[model samples]
Target chain A: MKARLRNFLVALLALAGHLALTSPAAAATADPLPSWREGPARQAIVKFVQTATDRASAGFVPPAERIATFDNDGTLWTEHPMYTQLAFALDRIRELAPQHPEWKTQQPFKAVLDNDLEALAAGGEKGLLELVMASHAGMSTAEFEALVSDWFKKARHPRFKKPYTELTFQPMLELLAYLRSNGFKTYIVSGGGIEFMRPMTEAVYGIPPEQVIGSSIKTRYEMQEGKPVLTRLPEINFIDDKTGKPIGINTFIGRRPVAAFGNSDGDREMLEWTGAGKGARLMMLVLHDDAEREYAYGPANGLPDTKFGTFSQSTMDEAKQKGWIVISMKNDWQRVFSFQPETMNPAKK
Target chain B: MKARLRNFLVALLALAGHLALTSPAAAATADPLPSWREGPARQAIVKFVQTATDRASAGFVPPAERIATFDNDGTLWTEHPMYTQLAFALDRIRELAPQHPEWKTQQPFKAVLDNDLEALAAGGEKGLLELVMASHAGMSTAEFEALVSDWFKKARHPRFKKPYTELTFQPMLELLAYLRSNGFKTYIVSGGGIEFMRPMTEAVYGIPPEQVIGSSIKTRYEMQEGKPVLTRLPEINFIDDKTGKPIGINTFIGRRPVAAFGNSDGDREMLEWTGAGKGARLMMLVLHDDAEREYAYGPANGLPDTKFGTFSQSTMDEAKQKGWIVISMKNDWQRVFSFQPETMNPAKK
Candidate 1:
């Protein structure tokens, strides 16, 4: 029995060594955020996580309280050609155009159908709200989810010529996983429709639906033909942008985030709210300065101004003044999308 | 080296044997629900958990989909005489009476102050709303949380003559742990104030604030003295009762519950919605039939009717027709509160 135990122990040691050599955790520890180039922003995030997780450190945060919030649109994915949800809304409008012949003559609907971007912008918030109501609501939640899922399956980014999910910021994805591995509950606090995001967030971002807080339309529970359904209403219930981001975080998460990330003025309040929390804190804003690689229209750092995801000059000033790390797409990111050739797009490669 | 390895293996095996004997998991498996008597209801819960968790079982639910919802008030704790929230509201009226001199002359306030149950009941819904709004709103979120925490520290149940937190059903607590052990994520879906419940739910029920979905008043996000604060506003944002329960579950959880527990007609929609799910489902109602032990007011099994948590005869009929289990307080629960002497109260013992 003693001889057998000795042989078994030697074999176990050999197996332990083999497992250690192959473990992902061991490899992950070397460079958790490899997509992020060595920069102040990456250093800031790593330092915050280290201090917050270190048991002996004064800045240590309990795992239960290690909440981190991230904005979805410009922060996580490409919002350049227009927000993905807007793209979905436009496609939906065209798909349903035959059913509604009046849309051909309408302002926003006609703009979308005729591929007139300027006309859609001129119609403004009211036009956007109308489009959202028409496309996103008036169906059972399950049916709406199915529609969104089907759209995601087929819809491709106009510029990237790939699915919207493929356009996610690889550096941010790594950061999310890193925070999660460090015991932080990473949440998407977005201005996008809650129902629209819920269908795909888990698969694309690794953040579950319950963790994704966003703008929402009201839903009513009713029985139809002896079956229960939650019907999505056209009326807007909540807007999870600007000041609404903080409110949404408070309402859904019920905890203060120690770390926050956003790329535009819309996320200003959320950053402020998160920064106000005590102990180790990290807040970052992604700067779209790499115009050659990705569409750069921050209107901050002398980039061309665009209506979508406005990163104002004043917001940049605030980021500097408040000690919030500003990530330069040109400098901080080694790669933006997973589908992109390691360091550059195939055209550049 | 061989002798040392053999000795280490023998010691390791002995330590493992000792740990196995002493492990909480080993003891827990013996009887996960000691507070639940051997009955159809307890058996039903155990069987459902087993079938749902077993990977080989046809009714197996993935860990991610093992969502269980519970109603708070009468289902988790004693809700007789008046809801604990109602009691808190009345206490607040008295506490703030000197500041609000007009409250001395006000109908509901006067009724509360004078301890005239008849007059308070006569004032009805309007009176209750006035109490709720005045007591619940106008404070900053942090301040409100502090106030609630302070109240819970001192507040004692009128009947139990113990802290209200101590009045929580031990059987339910055990059941919650059991479900959690079986990989279920338990959430409290209640008609009570979200803020009121959030402060103590983590400590009391082992349910986090984010998992506690309840009715809430509107809150405004603002900068006060260069610090961000969310001020509670006196407008009803949501009422998570009846049909609203299903809507709340869908809106917050974004998934149908596999199991639901409640005690009243208000929870009918929640239970029904949960049961409508395709997989293994468990729907149960707590029938308060032990008047001698706990105040019985189901009005379900010919018990006395009450204003709060009215489990009507019609609801009982629906439960039967739907094949939902009705838990008898007299028979099903071996013990209620942890403070209640082992099997019975001192008088009965």
Candidate 2:
């Protein structure tokens, strides 16, 4: 019996050696989340996730109920001086400006046509909304999707001169995929138009249209060629921005996600909803502090060049009190946009 | 260095001895998904999932985009004779029936009051829709939710004489949690009213309202007490049953799911959409084939005691050809509803 035990021990040792040999060297190391910097923002995120996932932890959320929501324009990707969608729309305006002579004469369209970023930014939400309505609305959902798809393939960021999809933040992209791998459903809740987003959302955000919650225009089901087709109408359906984000989420999804992320104060309600829930929740706000890496802007003295809405002292205070994570773009991320080094020549100070 | 290695090895051996001393003999393994029986349907599911999750296997799917959709009602829980919502509504009707003398004169209500389920079933979708609209519509979303929650607490299934929520299959409940642990997002795409499903969805299915896609009545945002309130209207919004399920999924979810489940032909399109999509997908259908254990029903010959929509053989053939799994309740599940033994008296053969 002792000899048999010795043989069993020898076999176990041999098996362990085989496993060690087959495993990659990198697989054995304790690596933190790849793009995460070592600090409170990172620490808070890691700690929250760890507790939620650890079976022994007090805050352990069942893996099934682990739902995470992210804002698209700024939180998940780069929303600089203006949203990427606005930039894309502006480019479309330029491309179609000559065809519609009235655009050259119109106030907002003329500003867009003249390449007057200052004057265009002066329009604010109302003016910008009008521009979006004129340029984005009126077309059928399918046609609009096709147009956006074509534009995405060809349109390049004016400053970065890279494909718009490539402008997505690499760190956040990795984080989204990582969270999903760890049993979280990542949804894109943005202020961008729903139709404008659906075309590229799957490929870029790894979130499909159903998971994408944004501003929407009313649509109707119509029979075209003996088959039912959804047609986008010019009427305002639901605008899922600002305080509307939470309301939209509640209306569309019907569940308050455990984890929420955003860049601007527009996302304040969503973050509050996420963190204020009964069980364990994590809310993150991305602060674009690195002007050279991306545009730096908050509520104070709004720079027309700054794209995202704004992050306030009130929001920051709430973040602190509620144990919400505030990610400093300047410090918290080793890498910013996916197009870094390749497309963006970091602006000279 | 050799002496230190020997000491470490000795310590490891001691630890192993301690582990063996503490470890209890393995208990007889219970079926993890006890509601299912041992059959081809069960085998197909286990085999497909195992192969799909195996990284080195040919069918390995990257874990990030694993999304599964399920048809509620018969697919996940019981939707016999009438939907569970209708059951709630009926209970509400009976409780409120004393208050409204007008219901005594109404056709469907008259049938309901008379306990003529046969006559009520004869009314079909149109009649059921009318009944649902009358009982479920014209209240604030919150009010409706409260009503649902109130009904859930008191309402019991007529046959089983247990709360309807308690009748949910235990194995399916575990499967939902298990799939989520394995990086799958479980969504309910049902034909029931969205609001009707939302109130109890989180508690019962571990799925929130946002994850639920169902038929809906029109609603509008109204400012009530200086806050936005969604007021449910008495008009049809989106119907999410039969062909509507696929359409609802397409419009609301936007992405094709990696997996889908349903019991009847109403879920045929949803299954087709998932399995026929590009890349890896798993589709399943629950077959109610055990009369002794639970109700056995299909289009050919189903339970006369209870009735709902049924599926055809062609649909089963299609599922077989497309590699979709069909789970037999009698064969695959070891246990049926969570309330089994305690709540339900197993039908004597």
Candidate 3:
């Protein structure tokens, strides 16, 4: 009886193995919109995307017309305290300072080297522009690209201590992918220099260099030793900020985006332009609110000395009145930066 | 006896059905490379491509790094008598002549409108450059893009009377596809304006706008009513001709192509650059030698007015010695142009 039982068990096991081998195990998992924290804003966005993508839905748009524009600095990634490009430019200054003796005694450069946040902050746009121009200009586009690639490899953020690219919001990456899968041709329409963003945009954002519309510097072609060269000029060619965003988009793309995203008043025109378009349009603004997970300070909500600041409530009120999607970072996102792994343990102390 | 007869009839019918299904008589006829005449040159290309692409062979390079650069104008399509862009610019002059009254009285414009090929050609480089600059510049990038899209729709080639894009070489298109299948990133490094090439590259060559590197005009960014505008300047920018070809390729792509193809000495530098690179480089030149089948041309054999005339026997010898693949149009190509159907039949009547 024991021998019979053993033989029966072996036969069953063989049958199970045969069934498993013959089964269609390579079936792809269905990719749905990732579950966002349940809320009215999330619901509206989900509904819009679903309706627009659905063939049977009344709000359905043709795949060819499904263009979406996204702001990179704040909407797609964390831009707290200051824009990431500023951070990159600042780090570049430090790396380059040793080569130039004058910078050791320079006002802004000295402030940057000394880590005097107050003095650097006081420098404002004029100071920042000088810092950027000194560090970013002069290199050939190819040289600049290599420099950026090198910087990305070594530099880490002051607070997060993680690579700047790693600080990109996980939820936003999912949204970009979701939008793409739904037949949207996503673009980065921002105030960033076109060349500066072109180097890393493809790897980090999946947006090609050509699709990135931004501010640009004047370039001239000159024949040096019978070979043509593209030289970058220090002159300001275009400033893609505030109201300039919409016009830049219109001029470059020749068509209006069906959806737009932004985090500050700088992107107000882009959102306004998208919302003004006919038929289906979706616009969203990311409001920073989590103090523990992320630094939070709106014009009305933060401590006087806090570095983080937000747009006036009037802008949020305007967004609400316009039926725009205002995402509350604290309430909507399941997680912030995707690079942070799920579990963290202190090294055996 | 009846049962035996019925069984015999069933067997005979079954045999007939099996033969009908299995035999070539019931199968579709295969397509031959119809345009290609039987020749040793054609045989060599076909055999080499087949051997290289075969997975069983030792020489299997992945498609991503299979960079193939082709010269525009003559190599891929017909640019005989006059370059295609020149024709477009002349037509543009005529279109804009009414708007600019001065053009009607002008030498080049008058010649263009009057259909005097002699007078138009008389203008040479000075007049041609001026005409091109006037017709091509002063518009926003968007306006120029729209103009191209519109012009392509209506303009017909003077010789073929078909759309210029339709005049592309059919065999080359097949070769491009075959190369792509085997892992090649094809690019058109042309002497044409970058903006001019971009509007139609995707539709005509299947090359994305960003992949095309060519001559360009300086553009400036201006804030017009709060929007950034990229204004095309009248000043000459990069001239991607002669030695500039290789330099442009290096600047834009940051790597040397493995394979390069051209039809003229304008492509000499490009071919040289490709050959100079280490390891398994393939450089081919399309020698136009079939006047009967297409247009006959060589620095020694055809068209005196051609920019570099044609390839000389001594030049051909040097190319051969350098291990370059010289594709004789008369021998290698199956078809000269994609519009052969129209050429073959003037009318159904």
In terms of lDDT, which candidate is strongest?
A: 1
lDDT of 1: 0.88
Instruction: Please provide, for model 2 over B11-66, each residue's C-alpha lDDT reduced to its tens digit, 9 standing for 90 to 100.
Output: 65565555445545323445555555557766666676777688988777777557
- Compare the candidates by DockQ and give the number of the best one: 1
Give per-residue CA lDDT, model 3, range A1-349, as digits (tens).
Answer: 2445445544545544454445454234454534355677677777888888889987788876788998887778777777777888888898889898898788788888888879988987788788878877776655777888888888787789988888787778878888898889888887877777777777898886656877766555454565444456676766777766775665455467889998777787778777766777899988777665555666533433333324666677778788888887777766667654423212111
Instruction: Report clash pairs, candidate 3.
Output: A237-B221, A238-B221, A244-B226, A244-B227, B35-B334, B36-B334, B63-B183, B298-B310, B299-B310, B299-B311
**Model 2 C-alpha lDDT per residue in residues A50-112, reported as the tens digit of each score:** 888889977888876687989988787767656778887787778777788998778888899
* Candidate numbers sorted by TM-score from highest down: 1, 3, 2
Sort every candidate by lDDT, greatest first: 1, 2, 3
lDDT tens string, model 1, B1-349?
Answer: 3445545655665655555566665545568898887889998998999899989998999998999999999999889778989988888889989999888888989999899999999999899999999999989999999988899889988877888888788999999999998899999999999889999999998999889999999989999999999999999998999999998888888889999999999999999999998878999999988776787785787867877999999999999999899998888888887877775743335
* Model 3 docking tier (incorrect/acceptable/medium/high): incorrect
DockQ of 2: 0.19
